[model samples]
Target: MEIDSKDGIERKLNMAQQSDFNDPVISEHNIYVCHVPVNSAFYRVIFPTSKINPYTNKWLKARFKKAVRMLEMRLPQDADSASFDAKKAKYIASQQQSTSKTSFVMDRLLAYEDIFIGQSHSFDAAFEYAISNIYLCPMMGSFEMRHLQAGLQNLQCDEAIHADTDSEFTESESETDDDPSPLRVRFVRPENEFQKKRREESVTLRNKVAEHSSWISLDLEKSTMKSASAKLNSLFSLPNPVDSLLKLRDAEHLVEETIVGNKLAELNLEDRHSLISFKEVRRLPDALQLKALFIKVGVISMQHIEELISFKIEHNLLISRIREYAHLVRGVWVIKSELAFPEDEYSLQRIVRDFALCLLNANLPVRRSDMQLAFGLTVEDFDFSLTTFGEHITSGERTWRLRIDGDETFGKTKEDLRVLIEEKRYWNRRWEEIHHYLSTIKNKSDFTVQKTFKRSFSY
Candidate 1:
C-alpha cells in the first residue's frame, strides 16, 4: 500500500507528530501514526486497550462509516447537514429488532458488579455507568447514608437530646422594632411520648450502625466467619448508651464506605478485564455507515453482518459497552443503524477508507501509512485535488475562509489560494461522505493503496 507524497491527509500526518507547523511538501516514505493518549479521563472511561480480533476490528471501524451516513441521512447533499426521514426511521427500527446482544450485556455487567462491590481495583472502562451506579446506591455514593451514619456516632449529641436542650429556627416580628427578628430558639424537652419514641429510634439506629461496621473487614484469614461474628458481638458492648451510640455510628459510616468502595472497585476490575479481551481493531463498513454513503450500496449478507458486530464489540468500547449491558441497555448508539453498507469486497474497501477519513474530520487524521496498516486505497482513480471544494464563509458574524473537499475532485486546479487564505475550515462534508464510501469499499477484502504518504501537512 502506497500513498502519493502529494496527498493532503498524509502531509498533515507528517507535520502533526514530528513538527510544530504544517510542512506541506510530503515525502513518499515519511509515514506517521497518530496515537490518542489514553491517560485522559474520557478515554480511560470510554475506550481502553483491549484484545480484539483483527476481523472484528473492522466492524468497530464501521462506527466511522456510520458517522458519515448519519450525517448524510439528516443533512442536504454535501452541505454538512442532517434531516428527519420518517421512512428511514422506520427502516432503522426494523433493523434494531433483528440485532439484539442482550445476553452478552447481562453477563458482563454482573461480573463487573461483583468485582465493584468487593472494594478493590481501579476501573478502566464502565459499560453501564448510570444504571450500575444507581443500583449500588445506599451502598455507595449515598449522601443520605453518610449523613445518617455520621449522625448515629454522635452519642454525646444523643445524650444532650435526652438532657432537654433542642434548637429551632423561627422568623418573628419584634413589637418594639420595624425589622424582623431571625434567631435560633432554644426549647426545653416536652417530655411527651412522641419525643421519647423518637429518642429511642435514634439510639437503636446508632446501635445497628456499630453492629454492621467492619462486618466484612478483618480476620477472614485469621478466623472463620462464625468466630469473627462471635468476636464482633463480644467487642460491641458499651459502658453506657453514649459509648454504644458513638460506636454504632462509626461502624455505620465504615460499612457505608466499604460497600460503596467495593462496588466501585469491582466495576473498574470488570471493565479492565473486558479491555483485556479486546483485540487489535481495523475499520469495516457497517450497515449504518453503508446507508449513509449510497442508497443502493452493495449486498451484505448475514454472515458479514455478524462479523461486523464482533468487530464493534472488540475494538469499539461504545459498541462493546452496549453489547456488554444488552439486558438493560437498548437503542443503537445512533451509529449502529447500519442497514445499507455495501457488502461487496470492492465496495467494502472504499467504505473502510471513507470511514478513516471521517475520523479525520473528528481531528483523528490518519496517514497513508495508516491506510496501508488499516486498509489500502482501492480507488486508483482517486485524484485528491479534484475530490474537494474550497471556499470561505462568514461564521459567528465574522468573515472567515473555508475550503471544502468534494468527492471526485475532477478537473480541479491547485489548492485555491483565496479559499486557503480566507477560510478557517477548509475541508468539505463530501470528504466525510466519501471517506465513509471508501470504508465501505475496504470491508469486502484485503486490498490496500500503493502510494506512500508525505509528512508535510495537517488535517
Candidate 2:
C-alpha cells in the first residue's frame, strides 16, 4: 500500500515495513483510507504527516500496517477458488448478522431496556452519570435529547429507595414509578461564561431597539415630516445645498395637471350626458322630492323608491329616464302602452304572439302557465298565439322551446344521439308487444289488462 501526505509526498510500504511501527497511547492526527478495488492486491492510504505529533505519527503507522495485513489475508491466490468464495460468503453473512444484532440492540435500548451503572440505583443517578461521563471528556461538548430519552428509559433503578425515607421501595411502587421523568430532560444546557456575556450584550441591543421604537412613534405623532427626508435627517443631521436645489427642480413637475384628457372611449354618450347633468346639479335632491317623482311615474313601489333615494344620495347621481316610462306589474316591468289590449281580436293575437316570442328568445323552454300570466292571455288566446308561432317553436312535456335544427339531439353529438335512439327503439318495441297482447286479450276484463300491463312494467 502507498501513503500520500498533504505536502505532496508519497511513500510505498511493504508488509514487513508496515508491521515495524508501534501503536501510540494518544493520537490527534486525522487519517482516511481510500476505497478498495475488487480482487485487488494492495490499497491506497491518504495521510498528512507534516506537523503531526510523534504519538499521532506512530498511531497512523500502526493503523496502516493493520489495514495492509487485513487486505493481504483477504486476497486470494486463484480467482476461481471455491474456498475463497465460501470464505467471502461467510464473511458477508457474519457482517450482516453483526449489523442486524447491533440494530436490534439499538431498538431495544431506544424502547425500555435496563441500563445499569456501577453502584447507581436510581434513574436520576444513572442519567447524571451518563451526562457527566459525556461532559467529563474535554473533547465532548453536547448530547442530544433523543439519546438522553432513550438512556433515561433504559436506566435500571432496581435498588432505588423512597425519597421520603432510606427504606427500599416495594415491587409494585418500583414497577409503577420506574419510568424516568421527562421534565428532568432539558434541551438546553446551562449557560457558560462566554454565553452569559453574549446574553448581556443581546440585552443591551434590545434596550437600544426599544428606545429607537419609542423615538419613531413620538416622531410619527408629533411631526408632519416626509418619511425619506426625516430618515435622512435623523441619520446625518445635515442638509446639502446642492441636493436641496435638485429636489426643488424635481418638485416642479409634482403639480397636478389642470386640463384633463377626454375619456369618450370609456364613457358612452348616455353616460356622459348623465355625468354632465349630475355635475350641473352638484347635489342630490331631497327624499320627499324623489318620492313625489316616483308617485307621478306610477311604477316604482314605496320601498323601491326609498332604496333608489338612498342609492342616489350615496352616489350623488341621477336615475336613468328610460325606466321612468315603464310600469311595474306582477313583478315584471311593462311599457304603458302594453298595459292596454287592442280593441280588434287580430291585433291582440299578434301582440300576444310577439310577446311570447320575446319571452322565448330571452329564456328558452318558457312554461305555458308563465306565458299566460306574462301575456295576460286566457287558454283560447294562448292557443291562438301558439298556432301563430307554431313553425318557430316546439312543445315539450309541459314547456315550449324554440324549434332549431338538430335540437332533437339536445346539444349532444351524433354518437350520443345514436345511443339515445337505440334506447328509444327498445322501449317502443316493448310497448308494441304490450299493445299486441292487449288486442289479443280484448275479450277479457279491463282489470286483467291493467294487471298484465303493471306486471310488464315491473318486469
Candidate 3:
C-alpha cells in the first residue's frame, strides 16, 4: 500500500479548481437572493458544500488562511484553532435558527460547514458540531402562507439592498447555487391572531374565486343564447315603419285617434278611483294631452315617448304615465313600429359617473363584473353599450379605471366641465319650453271641442 503524498494531493486540488470552471456543478449551486421578514433588516449568504479538508496535510495550510479571512474581523488571528472552531460552530448553529420556515437550514448549514472545517481541520468534527448545535425552530403557520410571507420578505430585502449597497452580498451577483444573500437573517414574522385570520379569509376567498371561475356546462349553455342574441341585436337592426310614415299627416292622425278613443274607453270608474287614491287622477288628461301633442309635433321620436314613460316612473307617477303607454302600444302595433335607438350621450355620461364612484370607493381599478355587482346589476344591465363605455373609461388588464383627468374629483379640475354642465341645462330648458308650448295648444283644443259639443246639443 502507498501512502498519499502532499505533492499528489496538491496536483488534485489544482486540477479540481480548473475542472470546477467548466463543470455543470456551477449551475446546481445557484445563487439565490434570499430575504427574511423576521428581522426586516439584513440578508444572509448561503454556500453549497462545507467540505474544506483534503486527503493530505499540504491542503490544510491554504484552507486555514481562507477561514481566517471569513472570521477575521470578528475573531483574533492569534486565536487557537480549538477556540476558532468552537466559535465558528456556534456562529453557524445560531444562523440556522434565523432561516425562513420553508428554507432548508441543513443545506445552508452544510455549505457553511466547509468553511468551519478549515478552522477545525476535521470534517467529521465540524459535521457533528453542525448537526448537534444547529436548531430549527418550529413554524406556526401553514406552509403556503409561510412561503408567501417569505417571498414578500425577500422582495422587501431586495428593495432595501438596492437602496443601500452596504449589504451588497445579499443580492444575487452570480448564477451559482450558493445564495448570494445572508441566510442567517430572519426574513419572516411569526404568525399572530390577526395575520392568521387574514390568511384564512384570503384562502377562503381564493377558493371561492376558483369555484366561480370554473366552467360549468349548464351555465355556459344558458348564457350562450343571451350573448348571441345581444351580439345579433347590435349587429343588425330594422327601421320602424311608424318612424317612416310620420310624414303622412292622415295616416299618423288616424292612428292617434284610435289610441285616444281606446284609452278613454279603458278609463273605468274603478281605475279612476285607484288613480285618485294615488293623487294621480288629475294627471290623466295631461297624459292624453301630451300624447296628442306628440303626434302632432311629428319630430318627437318614439324614443322621446319611452323617455316620458321612464321619467314618469322615476318620479312615482306611473299611474299617470300608463295612460300615455296605452296609446303608444296601439300606435306601435298598428304601424308595425319599433322605437328608434336613443343617443347614448346622457346615458353614457351617467354610466361613466358610476364607474368613477366605483374607483373612488375601491381606490383601485376594479374588474367590470365587480363594479356591476356593486350596483346590484348584471353585466348586461348597464344603461349604455359596452362599446360606448370603452371610449370614456380607461381599461386595464382585465380591469377598468375612470378617466378622471379634467374632472371635478379624482383628478385635476377644469373649466370644461362647467361649460358642459351649462350646455346640458340649456338643452333641458329648451326641451321644457317646447313641452309647455305643446301643453298650451292641447288645452285650447280640449276647450274648443267641449264648446262645440255643447252648442250642437242645445235644445
In terms of lDDT, the best-performing candidate is 2
Report the alpha-carbon TM-score of model 1 versus the true structure: 0.14
How close is every model to the real structure, measured as TM-score?
0.14, 0.14, 0.14
> Scored by Cα lDDT, where does model 2 land?
0.36
Candidate 2: tens digits of C-alpha lDDT, residues 1-459: 455554547866554445565554342322232222222222222222323222222111121112112110111122233322332233333333433344654433322211111111112211112322311111111211111112222334333222332222233234445554667635477878998899899989865654453111111111344864554244323335577576563432332221122331243322212232221122233523442333233233323444444244421132223233333222222233222222354565645554444444345455667766544568776775554223323434566543322223221555434444553454355446545644554546566989999999999
What stretches of model 2 exceed 4 Å from their correct place?
Answer: 1-343, 391-397, 403-459
Which whole-number lDDT from 0 to 100 does residue 427 have in model 3? Answer: 39
Q: Cα RMSD to native, each candidate?
A: 34.2, 32.5, 32.0
Give the clash count for each candidate. 94, 0, 20
Specify the poorest-scoring 10-residue window by lDDT in model 3. Answer: 330-339
Give the runs in model 1 whose Cα sits over 4 Å from its true position: 1-190, 215-259, 265-459
Backbone clash total for model 3 is: 20
Candidate models: Cα lDDT each? 0.30, 0.36, 0.34
